[model samples]
Target: MESSVFFENSEKKKKAIGIIHRVYLSQLKNSRKYLASTKTKSEIRGGGRKPWKQKGTGRARAGSIRSPLFVGGGVIFGPKPRLVYKKINKKERKLATISALFLKEKQLVLVNENEFLNFDQIETKLICQLLSKFELEEQKKILFILPKPNKKFWLSSRNLKNVEVTTVTCLNLKQLLKASHIILSKESFDLIKLTYGQQ
Candidate 1:
């Protein structure tokens, strides 16, 4: 089958294919970098004064309550939150997104345009039935992309553990690449073409 609309014209997709690993690893590293760490010594409370006399006790030299050797002591060499944002060139970011999009093209499922011109009304039963019809019921992870925010559809799919709903404008590489199946509303498909293909 032919490649998706975004990949139809330029060598952008080819460029993306060449640097997939660099982009993906950059993403993976950045994802873990920003998360706050729990065991920092400063965050731990109460390491005030020396516990006992230093020499008379004949035990390990007593130190402040925060000594690492003590029971309630502060952590030693624990992790702390640090800057983790990786900067990729704008063109590279776009290329990586397009690359991921093209890679996932075969798994893309575009809603039938004839069934519903505007799928504004979110009905759980109807959505579930559609899932069955599309043979997506068994998929472990599915992403629902809409042209814009639809409170109704988002609420409807909120209960499905394996499904997520988002608009084309807010598409993120992490979320896009993580899903096993991508169900794009007709409007979303059009928006994606306009947004990425134009570049």
Candidate 2:
């Protein structure tokens, strides 16, 4: 395969990496989700009856067992289960992704598909040894973008620290920015262009 196959991009050179930070946080915020929930006042038990008469008890007017002041009472205005995802435009997503591609310097490495085929079998140790050949074993953060999701490849790299494997379709701005070093499978390189370069 040609070395230029991985780096060919009409806009890569003109694109500024710094531009991505503008929308990075927004994209990240929208992507994350949490299963948060809280109980309402009425949901609390034992609030059925009044604790005392309304008038002259002189005890500051006690209510039911489920009052906010009570030990086991429901929380007041606590977090509720609601979606917090922010909407991002397709153009913005494309811009952010392209910016990440442009940001890569010497840290980006491309692996030809033939190299993977040379492996007798896929294994964690085998993948590590392969990376050592590139002197990449010590890299603190590495991301591998496969052209397509390969279960064997994912399993092979899953156990390695500072290593993550994802397919082209799953690529996002967050993963692209998180890694210090990026490895693009030959197919992934082409797919990125096809998916994001036309516009």
Scored by lDDT, the top model is 2
Over the full model, what C-alpha lDDT does candidate 2 score relative to the true structure?
0.73
**Cand. 2 TM to true fold:** 0.79
Task: Mark the regions of model 2 whose C-alpha exceeds 4 Å error after superposition.
Answer: 1-19, 31-37, 56-63, 69-71, 118-120
How well does candidate 1 score on lDDT at residue 127?
Answer: 66
| Model 1 residue-pair collision total | 1
Best model number under TM-score: 2
TM-score of each predicted structure versus truth: 0.69, 0.79
Off by over 4 Å in 1: 4-15, 33-76, 113-122
Alpha carbon lDDT at 138, candidate 1: 45
Every model: Cα RMSD to truth? 4.4, 4.3
lDDT of each: 0.72, 0.73
Task: Give candidate 2's error at residue 27 in angstroms.
Answer: 3.3
Would you list the clashing residue pairs of candidate 1?
Answer: 47-66
lDDT of 2 by residue, 1-199 (tens): 3324433664643444444765687776776776677776689867889978989887878677687788888888887766787666777678678657755646788888765555555689877876897788545788888776677777888788889888777887888888888888667788987877633
Report how far off residue 53 is in candidate 1 (Å).
9.1
